[model samples]
Target: MNRRHFLGSSGGLLAGLALPTLASAAVAAPSATGSAASSSAGGRGYRPVVTLGGRTLGFRLNNGVKEFHLIAEEVEQEVAPGMSARFWGYNGGSPGPTIEAVEGDTVRIFVSNRLPEHTTIHWHGLLLPNGMDGVGGLNQPQIKPGETFRYEFRLTKSGTFMYHPHADETLQMAQGMMGLFIVHPKNARERPVDRDYAFLLASYKIDPGTRRPDPSEMTDFNLWTFNSRTFPAIPPLLARTGERVRIRVGNLTMTNHPIHLHGHDFRVTGTDGGWIPAAAQWPEVTTDVAVGQMRVIEFIANAPGDWAFHCHKSHHTMGPMGHGVPNLVGVDQKAATAKLEKLFDGQHYMEMGSSGMAEMQDMAAMGSMMPLPTNTLPMMTGEGPFGPIEMGGMFTTLKVRDSLAPNDERDPGWYTHPQGSVANKVDPKRTDGLPR
Candidate 1:
């Protein structure tokens, strides 16, 4: 299997999201430069969605209708550094390019199936004619291999929506065949935002040294991801301080994720149903996104700092690790280490988790830990300014800075604190009104 990594730039430009083999790769989304996704459409301003490690699907205006193309194909998705798996997705990437348009716009999506099996796309949460429902046999025909099909619908309302295969529903989606479909209101001013971002939540059970995701494993998913990529490998979302940032998250995995963000109290401004009324909106630091659901949260980026953003589930924030390992905490491994060292010529002797698993990460970081299998990532890894971040999986930072240029999606790096603002250690023996 070939190894791959996500595309990122050192400067302000954000790269497009698509594997090399995508059919519609020519028409890619705009590179992130720190600007709202707004454009002039029919004399009205339209804000385009920015997908994390993905592209916003572009369209062609033909006779007043926006036309888009989708190609269902195989993709080798890099879950994180040193880890990857074969997945099925649209336009050559799992959690395919985001489909965006405006309310009251007539959009025609041409889906071409290039996979070995037949597939059909179900436009989740869109009100349309029953024939356009795309439920394989229930309403429409399955798109056979090498065959193309079209789905046309009028956008009756604007909200957060999604699209996935309703054909094999099980094995297909389990292999990561999903994407977001966002419809901006006809009037961009209705729900204006400074920075709008989107991503899909997906989980896969891929064993170390393997190349394909185990679609059959439901309860034992070991890889949790945002936008088909993991922490350290996933890029941070950038924003200017005091900007109203909107993050739209869609869940396609079997499980739910309680996404939490540090430093801000946001409200669920929108759901799959529609935008929530202001009176009904409630402030929350974390929101639970269930399977086949979507949530949109918005907040003012008043705090200029790198805020931790991730799933609340502790296990969901870790990479590949043995779940059946024995509990060795507090065990006396001094004698065992000697015996094992002599048996293995003192080369393979090491105490694992004798005190805690955190030490294991330190050992690994120092290159003294046992070797991991090929294509495997450390369970807990990430270097921070102070020390190790001690996190993985669906983890990233919302970097809010006071000096980011408009649409400059470049990482602003670590936040520097002012004098007397950082926590300092106090002498334990003689401390006066200081932290002890």
Candidate 2:
């Protein structure tokens, strides 16, 4: 049988496979007189956590406990400019909201399941009791539809982590159910950072002329995303020059992502496992985040410019595309096009990819001539300063400026390059003795 047939037949078996048994334990007692808020008051100062264009998860204070609520439901989200998709997420956004807390503080997170199916939130890389691990039918009971479950745990460690459904793992995650969980160190002075940001890397396979993403896609994924958003829509990481910047990235996709930043060499400061010692850390321009893992990278924002930060995998930077298109790269279609144009009025066809594929951008800019299915994005998009960037998925910029307003999180627009800094064609008149 073919792969599709085998997958269809074994879907039920895969869903029924039992997860590893986890030891059940009683919930940890709340801290006596839980007033650790004063510890963060003047001692370490408030760490200004950034989430690019994303919002941080807010909490209510109840008897010295940081209480948060997350509701799992369906949401219609814009992946990029002019493109939107219906996704399953928490609190109405994919890659749900960023959850932030201070190390050593007690947090009470309440997850209400509004999805049609059961779900649970596994605090990825967090040190918590087995019963509160959020694995359905393994650690605790699944949060059924319309039911609420409470998970109380202490932030014993400080680092970047992730949260996603442990039940119906494949379909749920592919449908955009995930979030970033951050724990700041109590003593911010120990590892101080001027700007801290985090985002989750996810992928989806949305076939042409379709609105819903295919969750059963194992290898070929077309829509690569950052926090469930594509290029122009993915918010820029803004920072002031000379500031110490920390970017935490988590990968929930099936494939690994080798993220590369253009103008800086950064160090892998932390990982899902824990913090990497300063002595053992090495400088890298690109760091590979494996599946189900997270990596924290730090760098000094000394470069004052708009630099590209994106997945090194070239195809990951593209939007939804058909996989069965014919390869017209080196083909000479002039004669064929001439014959076809005679049959149609005012129709022009160009064979692309002969001299490097810049024409692909033009085609993308033209938009679809045929009507596409509802809620589907174009194969390529994203308007840039120069023109159509011809890029869509898994792409964003790190904009470092000399100065920015206090608490400014807005996109400062494109940068102004210094004189002679931009690339241009060499003058033919100046090439006196060059090879002709």
Candidate 3:
């Protein structure tokens, strides 16, 4: 966190500070509205929806994942064309759903607090039990708002894990609530792969004059993501040239992500639970994952096209903070001004000035004024073969495939393409063959 604790945290200079009015309010909800907020008075009919290959297990909240209470509304469509407006979600868009479960099963949930305060539900790196380890008031109590907790556990370790609001978790995970859970380890063995994707690396910090979506109580986080959209927004990762994929990396912020992938070099094989005995597999090409970490990679899609994964730090691939403001050329403005002048040595980046003025700068000078951006490093980032490189902040990609096939072809017209289909066009190879 830096820019001087992002401006001196209470939610940084009172920009919106309401952690239930500074903690201890525990539970609340009453503003009477639309059918008293349906779901037949607090939902969770609980059902794995369908189950296994039929792929099921649906949930929202039943309670205790660390003081639960997710509920961020504000509808209104049209994401482009005139940019329609009204965004923000939790049970819906802006990164919310994609739960799926398997491993040792059991996964029950219930969380129902239509919003107003008191929240919980941390499950960042799954290994449940200490009261489902959600960490609100340090294990339980806080669900308030409309009250409805019940997070049952049991998925003994899985590949990717994440949930949010461990009570003010860096401003309710920067106002979005965050998501993506996936477990699937009842034995997904069948190597040489085919297709499987799940990514949730994150980062956000935008206030270069209220351009909106900014939440840094100071220090790290400067917008960088995937699954919350960032790099060219979303594209790559499609494979079919020699298939063999399975990319499930996770890194739910606090910073630490070194993920590099101009072409290919994977085979870490499971961590956080599910496979790692094949003589302890290891053949990286650039990995480094910390902060609430996770890894279960496996590549061999034989480079088919559209590469450039990301996060190898270098200013998280660039494109913000005054876009090109004072950058005077390369190596990220001389390594962010020599790591912000070895983190001070001469001080002043926010000793408080820029007006709104004085009396609030001392979380250690707002956390050393600035320099936490080696791609946001906190829960995981990857780069430990010899240390000093962890900047992946969690990444994406791994689309190799030519026949390790298995699209299961589940209808929906198999993904309608027609109108000048371009014969499935492909040609960008380079997981290691060259010619991206």
Candidate 4:
């Protein structure tokens, strides 16, 4: 069978088997209501899906169905504290707004195309009629600029999904046209979570002197983001200790990210296909989210502290940097610096990369003496209590504390450790090596 036919047949077969199980589970579980219930209106009772600097899209009730409105437009967004880009996105922000819905409910999403180009929103990983699957010409007509398109469908299953343009997908998605679409289970009390959060991993390659992101870039991306914001600027996730936490991660970047969380071991609870069976779940401290994929990780917030949550790739933690710089490690530049300094009377040049490369970050954080190219983020930004953190992209902190409010998502500042709980400087005079 061809690809389309295969997908159609598989979708039908899965729906036939899955719908009954989902329905039976709904009947067996007690009806959840109020704040604990998953409702189409207001997403009440559901743990708020944190989007960092972004906001969730709200809906209005029309008869029994939920109605949502979206607008595609050009946006100038700050990817980090020092970098901003002009890109096309839905609503007013890049990565758009989070769309929340409940299973078994019909949702009517009206997308108004205000972008300069025609577009269509493909409901990634959603089960819907082929006609409602918003592919530009394959499934439906393209939503031309200045036109509005409506997609009405019943959510058959609840899971983490995404929405991005299928028309001119390469350029549109690369320019930042995407959003998170979450479907809460009809039987809300089945799997309970105290704190739920979601973020999309997106990367961009903005040429050093330009403010626009290049959609044609397939590799050598410079800017990395979580919901389009870099570390320090990316808001910290706050939670009370002992609470059940769920983090929904979606990767739209060209590369995979091994997201690591300090102080906790989490389980791969769900994926775009739906929740993983309990028997199949695996515990991991780091989970690799691959391109065009979604991963839902869950864990108990038993540790109380500000823990680092970031991509395990060391280079991914840093911001936009020159990839062409020649390796200077172990190279003696003292003579060259001395001659340069003498040539330029009052100038002093500092050699780098002998002891370590940390000084480069220190210099960048102190503000480069020379102005950086437009739309480029400093390779290292954000200050820590001790000194410069020397990190930037795809980084944030998961702050778990006993004193934090259950629903509080604000930054609680830095953690204060008890006396003797933190590492201290050691004296060399008192230390004697037993073995060389």
Every model's TM-score: 0.91, 0.85, 0.30, 0.88
Per-residue lDDT over 1-436 for candidate 2, one digit per residue giving the tens place of the 0 to 100 score: 3222232234333333222100011111111111111123212344545654466665544455566778899998888766778899987789787777778878888888889999999999999999999899999998999898889998899888889999998999999999988787887777887777788899998776555678899998989999888987887887788888889999999999999999999999999988999999989999999999899999999999999999999889888777777777788778887887777774875656665556767766676344556667766677877788777799998999987653456668899889999988987788898886
What would the per-residue lDDT of candidate 1 be over residues 234-281, giving only the tens digit for each residue? Answer: 778888988889999999888889999999999999999988999999
Q: Against the true structure, whose TM-score is highest?
A: 1
Candidate 3 versus truth, CA RMSD in Å, comes to 20.8
lDDT of predicted model 3: 0.49
Better of 1 and 4 by lDDT: 1
* TM-score ranking, best first: 1, 4, 2, 3
Judge candidate 3 at residue 232 and give its lDDT: 31
Angstrom error at residue 37, model 3: 44
Please write out the lDDT profile of model 4 over residues 1-436, one tens digit for every residue.
Answer: 3222232224333333322132121111110111112232433334446666776675544455556778899999887766778989977798888887778879878888888889999999999999999888899999998997889999999999999989998999999999999888777676888877888999888888788889888988888889888887787777799999899999999899999999999999999889899999999999999998999999999999888999999888888877887788888888888998899894877777765678787776666535677666777778877778888889988889999876666567888887798888988766786555
- lDDT of residue 148 for candidate 4: 78
| Error in Å for residue 24 of model 4 | 38
> What TM-score quantifies how close candidate 4 is to the native fold?
0.88
Q: Give RMSD to native, each candidate.
A: 6.3, 11.7, 20.8, 9.5
- Looking at candidate 1, the ten consecutive residues that score lowest on lDDT are 2-11
TM-score of 1: 0.91
Q: Which lDDT value does model 2 have at 18?
A: 23
- For residue 184, give model 2's deviation from the true position in Å: 0.7
Candidate 1: residue 147 Cα off by (Å): 1.0
Regarding TM-score, does 2 or 4 come out ahead?
A: 4
